[model samples]
Target: MPERKLTPNEVSYSAAISACEKVGRWQLALKLLDTMPQISIVPNAVSFNAAISACEKGGQWEMALSLLRQMPHVKISPNTITYSAAISACEKGGQWQLAFSLLNLMPEMTISQNAVSYNAAISACEKGGQWQLALSLLSNMLGIGLSLDGTTSGAALSACEQVSAWQPALALLDNMLSSQLLPNGLHAGSAASSLRKALGDSAAYELLDKLRELWEDNSNSNSNNNYNNYNNNSNNNKQPWEDSNNNNKQPEVRLWEAGQPVDQQLAVPPEALAAVFDVLSDVPGVIAIFKPSGVTTEEAVNELSQQLARQRHVSESVDLHIVSRLDHPTSGVLPLALGAVGSTAANWLEAQFAGRLVRKEYVCLCEGPSLGLTGCQGNVSTPLHTVELDGGRASRTEVSPIGRQAFTGYEVLAGYMPPLSSEPLLPSHDGEPGATGHADEQRPEGPELMLLRVRPLTGRTHQIRVHLASIGRPLVGDLTYGAKEASVLSSCPRLFLHARRIELRDLAGKPFVAEAELPHELEEVLAQLQQVAETSPEDGHQS
Candidate 1:
């Protein structure tokens, strides 16, 4: 195959032309256009149309328009596609004047009128907000006996939304059905969104019923028996590896061979140039000639329905997910880990955590050197916040103090609150001699700190944080509720929060527990605070 060039035939030019178009190389396309006639390559309408399309894609709108002006001199008449691409170029360039003018003049120029041509014109008008003009053109399209396609209908509906024309939107929806075009969710969304934005929340709320009804009806009629039969392949209703052909060994490609419009391009767009791009890579060219055998329009629609059902199945399956997201942190946020064990596992996990049947421990700063709030931040009681789930239910969170909380019965590891702490001095009091002396200062008003092996009876939101704050003692740095001198107590830089541990009953009701360490940040802060408490008697407030 010594590069058998076909003497610069239209086919060769078309291939080179399309390649240039796909890559957005307008200069190369123009250069190739110059070379076509050199090798006796007569420039047909297809050749020029492709070059124009290429130019449009390259953002050479003026150049593409120039090419159109040059169409008549080359003894080539602009076809529907030629004008369509030209109009599309004008639309893309935001040259609405040119776009509208060309569309109006198409008939006089004796160019054809097709769905693509109509779609481009309507979209331009929509983009330009020429609602009245666009509507007039759409009505005129019907007057000319060209049935509106989904593209036309969808654009009209979109324009309706852009212009805040809900009445026209409903009318358009009715027109879509009357014209036998199926209105999809995008169409419905446009109308609904417009209504919602125009009307208040209450009015928006009412549309939900109509939306629901339309969606149900649409879904029911959307699929054929073929899809239903395929779905029945499993009683489980889960088909990960499904499709008539599991093999993607070969793909089909489509090439526009001649004056004929590419069939693949004419029909619904294929995901790839080939029937399959990935798995079916080896397959030959696409189904180019698409009279579709004996497949009538209705049958084509049915097949389309089948394809859509499969795609929807894929879309729906992909959409199915288990996610554990935290709504807000301060109120308490659950780590995304919460969703991993869901449904039955989630329910079981919730039960054991709520029961708090499992024992726990925390190394807290007890205002004692032995207590060593170092690395072991002061412990405070906190509860797993109850989360309102879909059905208005609660789920428990598993947490513990800084370290491990194990064993059924709790035991204190170490630490104590310094006794004889200074109490708040009363302003009116006549001070006693010992009370006034530095050696005999009153004890501090707040409760002393100590290490404790406490067990929780229940899990509630902010249970630990709130409970500790409530008991005349809060974690050294917790300020969410209220901690004594918390605003200035920068010792523990963190809120003393930790997932700490989780406890739950296994399938057999056998208890299981997992603990996470106090992250280094919390540990470091605790170490410094404990050291301060040890050095000064007043540090622990020895009165």
Candidate 2:
């Protein structure tokens, strides 16, 4: 456009800066912002906002503040976005005091404080280990009726977790549920971690169980409401599939039988569909079950749908909608919507996942040489992209710069050393076969293993596995990502990954939480590791 004699205006320059902001090109974004004024185009708030946001993403807190100061010099007033970006930059740069100062300055400048600004400030406090300050800001935000989102709650919970402030964290969780904000795994996990730190393991587990029960009750109540609403709507709309002649008859399965011959049938036997899933929770419009390893999520859904149809005495299977899915080798809590495709309950459940309002937590056994030094807890923010394999028939995710954002946080629950190598055991003094020396004497030197509590914020495919692998700590039995380790741990049954918990909202906007205990196989593996640790010289305990 410039070559064609059409000079770029403020809009064009701002657009270029915004594009740079998305990819964290702070240098280029700042250069563009500087060039705008040189070209006689006055930089507006939009132009500065993009540049500051780019600086924020690049962790350039000083540069972001510099841009904010430059705004007033250019005769452009800062807005909420401008201040929020600057505060967020400070949060990322671990400058909690600067973040608070920016937040406090917002109101003085006649700008209304929004959730984003408060969230950034709270997160900065969280990073700074100032739980009291974080809670104070959160209380102020709530007192003023400002929007409280997951980020706001998460930051507060994290702050509390850092200080082992279990009571306040629990209160915040209760407040979240009362306010009808859906709490996901991260929120619950943070609170639980705090509780465990302050009280004990039993107390934390008890709290989670109670929470699940409370959410289940809420879901049951809302499921009834949804069923009533659906029935009322159906009666009013008079769906075409409904039989006018017989009100009690089931809806016709005309769509399924349209192209098939009368004699030729799509048969699915009742016994074949007799899936004996361990029902975790069975409310009106939702069903949470334990999906075992080796079964694909689709197969579990199909079998459950058929079983539900049989129970309802319908000739065809019900259209059970899948809200979330786990890999074929993963086993845990699987929640499914128990209604037609576009029904209120199904749509609500689908929306929770699509909007990322649902929270999922997993447990896995990860193996790596540096597992001991990887710390007791950390987060992986590596972006991931799915790539095709075997001529596009299969796919897997790998860390890539051009990929979409993905985050996975992990806490080490326990650690264990691998079994001794294949060296022959010395003969016993009593003439018995057992003569391996002390565990400390015979311990093998190889990759360390850990039991990890994992929470994946963004639900990318194989996110936990891929992210862990990217950090050199892959799941022990993950054949795809830990193929080299799989040969060594041949006794492992399958991928040692399980979706342990899930949190969601029903059609009535009530929160629903559920948990699936570890399968016997995985539990046995952990038990063996515990036994090994107990005998080892340096008991495998996380710092």
Candidate 3:
């Protein structure tokens, strides 16, 4: 417009600033906002709001607040939109206190608070790891007559999930139902994850079934009222296990009866347990299965034992002795002894793990390009202490001097760098800003990942996870020890640690080895990384 001899006014400047905000060009937006006043075009609240929103999208919280403060100096009173954008900027920056202060200040400034403002504050608390404060803000919103929405409830649920507050997470879901807000897959998934971590796989499965039923009832009601034809059509046809956003269904396991043909057993449809437990090795007294992620090790063993008894028509209770165990999210070789608990075979198998005579190798994808890791091979000797959380509902391992001794050997396989980009490759949240219903759902930009072959010499709770994180390289989806990196790479479905190989003596004292190939999902992630690497320049680096 200036080149055409027409001086751009505040309206034109605001529009241009908004255009920059959409593309996350916060610096350019601020520059344009500054230039407007130089040309005798007095900036208005609209101009400042656009610039503030631009900063928010760009994750420049300080600059956003600076713009907000300058608005008052320029005789432009900050309005609801202005404060909301500023608060959201703080949320993106992980500055929960500042976000809450801004929200509280709004009412004193005569700027009425809205759902957007409250959502931003609540999300900030979630990002800041303040679940209690997030819940408090959520309660305050309801007390002040602000009706709950998916965004509000999702943020609160995410906070509870992060802390493994299953009770509160379920309460929040119930609240969403009472408020007539249909919980999405993300909401249900977060609550299920919390239950899984705090209770067990059975509890999570039960919750999913309950939520699915509620969703179906709500969908039927809406369909009868002609509320949303598209939603009813699209959702009604989906399977009970399928999530709307994520279509991957949880695979099931089918246990075979004794003397059953291998081919026939494979042909049987999955039942008994809702996971893929591929039998790797079955000896006289030792049985090893590839335990898929999302099912606890104990749950897998118990279910398998019960299935075996039923198949054999045994009236007595069947108990499988667990020789080795893995975390709920860790997938791979899990060995169980078929002999009685105190039998010679069971004692021998347990002795191998207890005495560190067995060899266990794991492959994991961890946050990297780490300078500290240095070579192709390295070892970490750290004392790890497990601390109970939420009154023993959960626990986490940390490196401490007074903790139990733990050692891990690691060999770097490959490093995958993300494509170079000035802007984030993934959205900060799923649907909209501050609408991430689960902490594990948000996908912020992350550094390169290092695929490593790790061997834990000393068996301790979270040994490998804590050791790697102690050296500043945390696993991709380990929220307990590496919450920061896990949040950055939230696209990871679960913890990227897999038991690739296990070696121990069998019943006859012969050397036995069981190996499990990497799961298809993990392979897909690696394939995408390889594709990106081949397409990008060798020197291309994340900015």
Candidate 4:
């Protein structure tokens, strides 16, 4: 450059100061501030603020602090822009303490940190995974004479969602609602689906019903307005009333369809459960429930006959377990659960007589393909048959490839561990808890693994256990499904099989869905998997 000529205008001075600040030339920026006076120009508030920002952006926090003190010396007062910018720069430098100090020093006239100011600080905390800190900042933003806009809450909620913190994520959504922050489609979908999974059937139905109501109200408003316009036009033009009637009818039908409530929970209360048995007995299109026990056949017959009589279904007897439908061999039983009185006693007899149960399904955690023969990955392409403990009931199960349209889906939770800690677990169908019966089959050593999220579409007695075992993938600690493997999983403690979800149609052909979560034992096993995955990198497990 041919020796630079100086322009002494205020605009010229401000631009030079900005250029110095942009390039981290804090010393040069300060020099320019001082040099302005010698040029018969005074340092304005704009230039002073620029010099302070430069010091902060250049990592000179101390110099930035000192420059603020000199602002009054130069007869320039700091505005919100200057204060906010200084705080933001400190935010960028990870100097939150200094940023907060400066924020407190600002004019105590109920200052509000604009969107830009709070976002920078929150973003920094998020980058550091300081979730608690980030949350505190958000509360302070709202509590200290400020309200959070959609963007701030959205950022915080997104962090919570990513961490799978189900409850907090839900609360944030609720808070944003008070701000009238309408959730975009993606957020609504995620929040609804998550609420469904975490809160279960009742909550899921409530969310879906609320969504339906919202859409319904919108449609109804539109319908009412349309009908009003139609009626007005018909009256003014003397058009046919029939045309208006038809138009109104179409909209009313549409509104009703849109407004349908999703569901009503059919959960049987513990006390009303006897009422369920009453339904079983009284349901139409049924014959007498059949049950057989050697010693008490007469009493059993009398009581079951009375149960069926109360229901008004014909009373008869067959050597079987009473059930709604007995479409399959194992269909009549109460899931081999032995929850009924006495093992293989009078109640088991009723299951055999009902003869109306359609299907059965099982939920089991089979090893993934990575486990080779032991994993759920490979297909056996063969059927397997095993004898029952009674040596009288022969059980058979089949395995095929996990088909795409089979309606059976398994979501691998992507981790493994011993099934559960040594805490006492649930009882078995035989009225005894775990580690009973085989007594000698407990494993001596080694970690056991449990898969997650196994769901079955069709019900077949012992279907889940039998099918999984056919492919050499036994459940972690299933005594019946894989007796030998129970020992293998002895270290895991809990049986990894859970009846996660059941889907079927009622007698009226309407669909029904029920689900149960993993028991505490399984949860403990998953906790172990997480710990192992965290501590051991060579395993290369990413969860």
Model 1 off-target regions past 4 Å? 221-543
For this target, which candidate reaches the highest TM-score against the unseen true structure? Answer: 2
Candidate 2 matches the true fold with a TM-score of 0.50
User: lDDT by residue for model 1 over 1-543, one digit each (tens)?
Assistant: 127753557887878888888766778888888888886778888888889998777656798899999989999988889999998887666576788898888889877777777788887787667777778879988998989777887778667766677667666766765555544544655555455545533333233323333333333345332121111133333221112454323211111111211112112233432232111111111111111212332333334334534654553211111111211221111211111122222322332232233233332332211322222323333322232222233333233331121121122333334323323421221121111111112322333443434344333454554444433334444545434452324344545444344343332223444444555665675454332233333455321
Candidate 3 structure, TM-score to reference = 0.48
Ranking of models by lDDT: 2, 3, 1, 4
RMSD of candidate 1 to true structure, Å = 25.1
Give the per-residue lDDT digits (tens) of candidate 3, residues 1-543: 868999789999999999988776788999999898788999999999999998887768899999998887889999999999999989877689999999999989999999999999999898777899999999999999999998988889878877788778777866665565655656766676666666665556555544433444443344332212222234344432335564634321111112211111111122433244677887655778889899998888877777766765787646677767899989999988766654434555654554345789999987733322213577777666675543345677767643554678888676666534312332221232111111121112345567889888778888888777766667888877764533445667788999999987665445779999999988877786632132123344432
Report the C-alpha lDDT of model 2 over 257-340, residue by residue, as the tens digit. Answer: 111111111122334333567777655467688899999999988888777677769899877777678999999999887666
Task: Order the candidate numbers by TM-score, best to worst.
Answer: 2, 3, 1, 4
| Model 4 Cα lDDT, one tens digit per residue, 45-131 | 788778877776665666776777787787877777677667766655556666656666654735556665665566545434455
Per-model TM-score, in order, reads 0.43, 0.50, 0.48, 0.32
Instruction: Summing lDDT over every window of 10 consecutive residues in candidate 4, give the lowest-scoring window.
Output: 432-441
**In candidate 4, which residue ranges exceed 4 Å CA deviation?**
1-7, 15-31, 38-40, 52-63, 107-115, 128-130, 158-165, 183-543
